[model samples]
Target: MRIALLSYSTKPRGGVVHTLALAEALAALGEDVTVWTLGRGGDEGFFRAVDPAVHLRIVPFPDGPQNEGVGPRIIRSIAVLRDAFDPVAAKYDIVHAQDCISANAVLPSGRCIRTVHHLDQFTTPELAACHERAIVEPDAHVCVSRSVADELARGWGIKAEVIPNGVAYERFADTDPAARRAWKQRLGHYILTVGGIEPRKGSLDLLEAYALLRTKHPDPALVIAGGETLFDYRDYRARWEARAQELGVQPIVLGPVPDDDLPPLVAAADAFAFPSVKEGFGLAAMEALAAGTPLVVRDLPVLREVFADAARFAATPATLAEQLSAALTAADPRRQTAGRRLAAQHTWTEAARRHLDFYRRAGQR
Candidate 1:
């Protein structure tokens, strides 16, 4: 079957990563798959190289006005993508959208599938409308975790297919020793978190936790990486800076690291912290596990459902500090082994087969 997977941007966000990975896996299963995304900031390709078998259609979405607000930007984004995609929408056997904006862009066709990675409560009028329409209008839905699918059922009486994310286990598990040494040499012992400093990422909470961790153990510094996003969080960022200063903590914020360097950086970390307020799946935390690194994440239902006993859970900053501290010092070979085993089992091939099964069932309907 011919499939077109749509995502809003070519950035390193979770949904975009899922789109690319699933496309390649589907192609490997002898299906015709084409990945469609906006070439934001003139990005001609994805963050990492994709399999040559999958086709790509990077619709050039140039930046909007200098003073454009998030609402206007989102509206313009939908218009541009719709203009580029709607004309060709009829040819594909399946058009699956990965986010609200892409789902909205394909809304006119009334024949698209959606992957609701997670549900968010948006207050902005336009964004709230987009989010609601994206959820209600799709012909079918897929979610990365059972908790999220449960939310859809409770909120809208919608049932969705549950397809867990597949991790690139060997990419991180078999990272170059020299590359790991280089990150260790540069950053020393550090508690690393990906997805940058944002409200959803719980950046301020992590800062507070880091400060608390420093009171006893000052050996591990806080290193944050990967913050490329479409939303403007300058106000939140300013507040975070003030909190960091007030707590007497200075973290190394490496904005966006290269794709090739991510594995070694994760491998060299003392421990990985994922204190996000919301998440479909902790992809970065899973990568850390693939590298045999201890992980501490927020005590959310989705995380608990996905991670179980393979990771340490913390509900607040104080507990995050406590869990992070233990992760730094304590050595649980059983937990480490469990984490590696979990990461190894979630392969893209299995995810692809399940997706194909879902697609075929949908086609029959």
Candidate 2:
């Protein structure tokens, strides 16, 4: 089988990560897989290295002039990617798009499969249009969680196949002790969250929670890691900064942690915080579980569906703070063991087999 997996950017966003991982997994199954993505800002490769077996096509997407409106930029993005991708569409047995932008780029041909990682309520007119078309135009749909699949059904009477995300369990579970020790030495005892400060990530809420948490545990620091994104969040970031100052919370903001050092950073953390307002699957939190780190995630339907009892949940900042404090002080070894087992059960090989099954079925349809 030949597959072309499409994603919008080469950044460290969840969907891009999924695209690369799934491509490698599919290649391991003796399938011809090529990953396609826009090389935004001259990025010649992915945030991390990919398996040599999978082919890559990074289309050049240069940044537009300063003060370009979001709407025009989005339209231009679709145009550039679509023009770059159309010539290569016929080479693959399956052209699966991983996000709205990539899905939109492929939709003109009307012969693409799309993975709806999650549904979002977009207020911008262009984004709203892109989101809707991506959902409705794809020949077949895939979702990472049943919660998101259900959202598609409720919103548009669309039925999507559910395939859970696979975690790189051993990479995190067997982190180098020296690397872990080095991170611990640098950051000290801390709580960590990836994905940066954005509105959707509940950055302000986490800040509030961190402030409350400091009342009891002032020694353990709050560290934010990976944060490379395409969206504009300056207003939200400014608000977060103001709140942090008001709360007297000084978090160690290590933006875009090096890919090689991420596992050890996750491993060394006292607990991992995933207080996102929305999510398809809590991939970072799952990686933390793989590393035997206690995790606290927001109480969302998707998270509840994915995590169940393997993690602690909170709805509000105060409750989030409470959960973090408890997770820091009294993490149960039994839960940690269960988490490790759960992470082990979700392997890329299993995910790949299921994806192949889906591709065959969708092709027949």
Candidate 3:
């Protein structure tokens, strides 16, 4: 089958990760797959090396004025990708879009298979329109978790196919001891969270939780990595920094760690914290679990549906702090083993096979 996967950016966001890994898995299964994405900030390729079997088509998307609002940027993004992708949009057997921008771009190509990773509430007219069109315009929809699928059903009256994300189980689970030790030596006993400083990531809430955790246990430091985002969050970050100063806590902000260093970084952590307010699937948290790291996540329905008993859940900042403390101090080999087993079970091959079946069924329609 000829499949073309579309994504909004070439960055290391969760949806982009899904695109590259799924493309590789599909290619491995004797399917011809190509990934289409915008190369933001002059990027010519993805954050990491992709599989040789899967083809790449990176459309150049230049940066706008530094002060340009998100609405205009989103409009420009759709225009650039749509112009580049429209000519070849009809050539693929499946035109699957991974995000709102990509889905909006290829929405006019007659048929679209959109993966609603998560829904966002937008106020800007252009963004809200883009979000709604991406949700309802697609011929078929796919969601990464059953909770999100249920949301589509209840809110939009759309029955999206439920397809959970697959993690790189062996890559994280097999980190070398020396590499893990190197990270541990550099940052002694830290609580780590990825996905940069953004509102949806609940960065402010995490900051408060970390401060509370320090009141009782001052041994563990807070380490934050991976904050590459297209949206402007300087205000939110400033608030976070101001709050950090007010609380007399300094979190090590490592913005966008190299791809190779991610696994060891996850492995060396005393505990991994995921305080996202909205998430279709907790991909980074799952990676931490694969590395045999204790996990503490916000009590969200999607996370509960996905992580199940493998993670400790917390609803409030105080509860989150408590959970992090417990994760750092307690040694529950049983939950650790369960986490590893859960991560191992969500393989890309199985995901690709299910996607192929979905494509075949959708094509019949």
Candidate 4:
């Protein structure tokens, strides 16, 4: 089977990671897979992370900066659609689009599948229209989580199949003890949070929770690994830094660690905390689990679906802090065992096979 995975921008975001994982998984399963993405900076990096057998075709779109205003973004998305769908668009048996916002508008007119990542702040009226068109036109639709599928049914009256994202099993298998020690020596004893420092991600709430945690545990540092804020959410990074200073917490903001360094960083961290209020799927939490690290996650429905009985759930900042404290102090053998077992159940190979099955079924329809 030949597949064309369509995504507007394949940056270092979770959606991009999902697309790459599925593509590589399909390729590994003896399917001819080609990733069609908006030409972005981390294209080479993303491909390097995938299996070497997988093929990549980047379609560069003449779009404004990613942080541009809504008007320019819409115009740029239109331009992208025109360019991306003009040539060689109908060559594949399946065109799987990631994210319901942009890729939904530009897929070719055959067996197309749009994967809804989430429906939080990025869901605008234009995005809704694009998703509606895709739902009516495509042969099948997928959602990363049940919460997102339910939201699609409620908001746009479109039903979608649920397919959870998978993680690369080998990437987190067990770090070298020497390398782990070296990373600890370099970064110190720190609590790690990996994601963009934006408002919707609950970075401010994390800072508030971290401040409270610092009152009890002052020695461990807080290391936030992600890119600069790209949303219009009032510069939460600045506020976090100011609040951390006022509270006398040692906070280190490492803006987006390289892909090669992520595994070691995850292994070196004492614990992982993800206080996201909204997420279609919690990939970071999965990464932490894969690394045999314990996790404290927000009590969001999607997260609950992903973690199941593997993670400690907290609904608010205070509860989050309490959970973090417990996670820090106690030896959670059950959580560690459960996390490793759950991580083992989700593999890129299995995910890719399921995707190929879906594509073949969609093509028949």
What's the TM-score of each model vs. the native?
Answer: 0.99, 0.98, 0.99, 0.90
Question: Each candidate: what lDDT?
Answer: 0.93, 0.91, 0.94, 0.76
Worst 10 residues of 4 by lDDT: 40-49
- lDDT per residue as tens, model 3, 274-294: 999999999999999999999
In model 2, the runs with Cα more than 4 Å from the true position are: none
Cα lDDT of model 2 by residue, 1-365, tens digit: 99989998898888988889999999999999999888988899999999999999999998898987777778888989899888878877898999999989987755899999888898889988999999998999999999999999999999999999999999999999999999999999999999999988999999999999999898999999878887788888999998898888899999987788999999999999999988998889999999999999999999998888889999999999999999988959888988899889888888899999999999998
Clashes of 2: 0
Error of 1 at 202 (Å): 0.8
Q: Candidate 3: worst 10 consecutive residues by lDDT?
A: 61-70
| Model 1, runs deviating above 4 Å | none
Better of 1 and 4 by lDDT: 1
Residue by residue across 1-365, what tens digits does model 4's lDDT show? 77778666656678778888888778777888887666644333452356767777665554367567754565466566546664766777777777553455455454568887877544556645665565566667888888889988888788888888898656876777787888799888888999867766788788888888878877678888876322354556678777778877767878777777888898889889998888988888898998988799999888988899999999888988899889889988998989988988888777777777777776777
Stretches off by above 4 angstroms in model 4 are: 41-49, 61-70, 108-111, 122-137, 228-234
Instruction: Quote the RMSD, in angstroms, for model 2.
Output: 0.9
